[model samples]
Target: MRPRLSLPKPHRRGFLTAAAGLLGVSALGGCERFAASPTGRRALKAGEDANMFVQRLLLTPASLAKEFPDSQISPWFKPNGTIDPPDRAYKALAARSFEGFKLRVDGLVERPQDLSLADLRALPARTQTTRHDCVEGWSAIGKWTGVPLAEVLQRAGLKPNARYIVFHCADTMEYAAADENEEAETDKTANPDMEARPEGAENQASDSQAAGSEAPGAEAEEAQGTPIRYYESIDLTDAYHPQTILAYDLNGKALPVSNGAPLRLRVERQLGYKQTKYVMRVEVTEALKGIGEGGGGYWEDRGYEWYAGI
Candidate 1:
């Protein structure tokens, strides 16, 4: 187990300053050198360890980052990751304005939930404007509103073993279709006018038809089927943070489809990807290794760190 260290609230600034100084020195030296040298790695790790210790010590359960007034809202908040869902179900929901969509909350809770958009909207809500810092090095500010995640967890009666909360999404990485045996055999007998469609042309055709149809874009759209929206998991410490919420509204209005309509997770202290959009499920588990690549999140499995505390 990691040791929990505490420092006075007033000293946090100084602690960070000192840690930054150490980091500067460590970075200037080779990271390998720091790792190879027992003393160096210990010192470098000390900065992170100390920060975590201080946060655990000085920050009370009620402590929260400042919430700014609406007048301070950012002018533009770019959508990241999958902007538009390609699944027929998602498109159908989108066509119906998401009225038929429902969010499911299950796993390690006393009561499983199948909540409608209206049900989530009916819950007590919180709204705030916060900056989203992506690992890619861009930032955006947006207003978000949703029920507190703790409230939801409490309502569900979180199991004692639960240590992390996972968000499941409706998007996925696209894959290429494997070559068909029929196509391979037909290559020998195909007429000059009946050449096989190029992958690009096939994709373009699929994009033009509606999902579940023979129309040009239909197959493409349907094939894109509603991917399980991107999923991510965070430790229970952050899950229970006061700022963590299931956001239902953005900018004082119902969330647009482009911004994950109905509901989303807002874990303020982590990187932007940790704030999963188009959330369909929330699962509480003691360990993340059971999910995805056991790294905690989709991006985490793809090289991002799981603990992205700001």
Candidate 2:
């Protein structure tokens, strides 16, 4: 039998207070008239930048979170969004069980790399079992072990303009029609389905469709190939936090493919989505305004606050 571990009462209270305060701030920032106006937008950006800077300054660099005894580990750690990406490229990777998968680190860096699973495993690793809280109102406790993201960044030689870090993933949340159409056409030509397409045939069809939709102009944005895996970005302050890691192992073993096998971002302070899984590329940039509706992330563009600190 495992011991039932719980968070301290004061810590729980503090978490609630911070969440309420953040919600209030987001509510104020979301007012359309205020957020859309030039003056208001500038003011909001300034305020956000200032708040981030202050938080960075106050952060204790080496301070560690409390680690629990093994008996306290939760038995069931629930999987979050897009548990298995519907994207064909991701499915193919899953088929092989992700044995050949590699994580690429490029953009705004002096040294770009295509690191293999073995390469990542060789890096220094940290293990922690922390409580994961989601904005949708659920919580889970799990043990995660991985290399510190700061170490990976240091090895990459980030350029002076690198102020934000963007994570590109193999998973996607939505499937667009444009992507679907391309797949159908490719499948009809490549593999004729007399009775019905085989599972592999269907996947190939989907991949062809996804590939056909990429505009030539879109290709110029990054050297990487497309369907631009589900991506998210964060400012440098969060990027360098001690708790922010490129997790290669989870719960004391090689991470299962369903749990983002090769590498996953564990930005402990933010919401679950911000911790992107099956990360392929880590791009460091100076601004978020040019990335996806200029809000910060896919969810942030929809209405969720970018700074989901809790």
Candidate 3:
């Protein structure tokens, strides 16, 4: 078990109170208006940046979240966010027990690879019992087993400029028109190394469509009606942390669909929202511009802090 990295309970309470007071100053309508203004946006960005900087100082790259023994595992780990993705591709894979599923690793890398559940399992693996702290003020402890993210990143060979890692997942969430346009722009960035889709991409995509799933780029057709696929990003530091893993199992059994089946990110140091689920692709990038509203994550775009360090 790693040492616990946290503030004292009183300090945490004081911080929360100060934060709420700041937020309370702006009434509902005024808050929206202010957040939309240029100055307000800049101020918000500064606050977020400051918070990230301070948190990173405490949550160093090699610092691990406190882990517990098997005896401390929670009886019930409550599921949050999208438990079961409604996408046809996800449903099809789930139906067959993810036999044909493949996790694509691409973008700004020397070698792009597609790995299956078996492939991931065959790699060096880590299992730890860690507590999941949610943004909603809930926590659950569970044992997870998977390959360390660093192992996969090394296998893919990150490019010299690679600065961030993005997790593209199967789950989808709807956004307003403005948000949709922002997402459209994000898909425009080119990955030179991935210009030619990997072989596994074609195979998996075709299989998905054949099984009633929508083809890639179907989101455009849906327009106002379609839901954007979920995604999240983290820096190399977190990516290589010993405890950060691409979890495939929970407790002692296979991860359930309700808890991000086949694969999910277990970034133990951060809050639950950063723990993306149903992950399908790993994209290494040089910058986050035009990616998910330029905020680096699904929830981050909607005002959540990018670094949700405890």
140-234, model 2: which lDDT tens digit per residue? 67789988888788888878767788887766443333543443121221111112222232223233242233222333322222333457887
Ranking by TM-score: 3, 1, 2
Error at 249, model 3, angstroms: 0.3
Which of the predicted structures, 1 or 3, would earn the higher lDDT when compared with the native? 3
Q: How well does each candidate superpose onto the true structure, as a TM-score? A: 0.70, 0.68, 0.75
- List candidate 1 stretches off by more than 4 Å: 1-54, 175-229
Which candidate wins on lDDT? 3
Candidate 2 Cα errors over 4 Å, as ranges: 1-58, 61-63, 176-228
Model 3 worst lDDT run, 10 consecutive residues: 188-197
lDDT of each: 0.65, 0.63, 0.75
Instruction: For residues 1-310, write the lDDT of model 3, one tens digit per residue.
Output: 1222332223554455445544643534577788777856765665565465557656656888999998989777766676556565777788798999999999998889999999999999999999999887778899999999999988998877788899999876653455534543323211101132222232242323422334344565355454477899998878888999999999988887667888999999889889988999999998988887888998888787888877
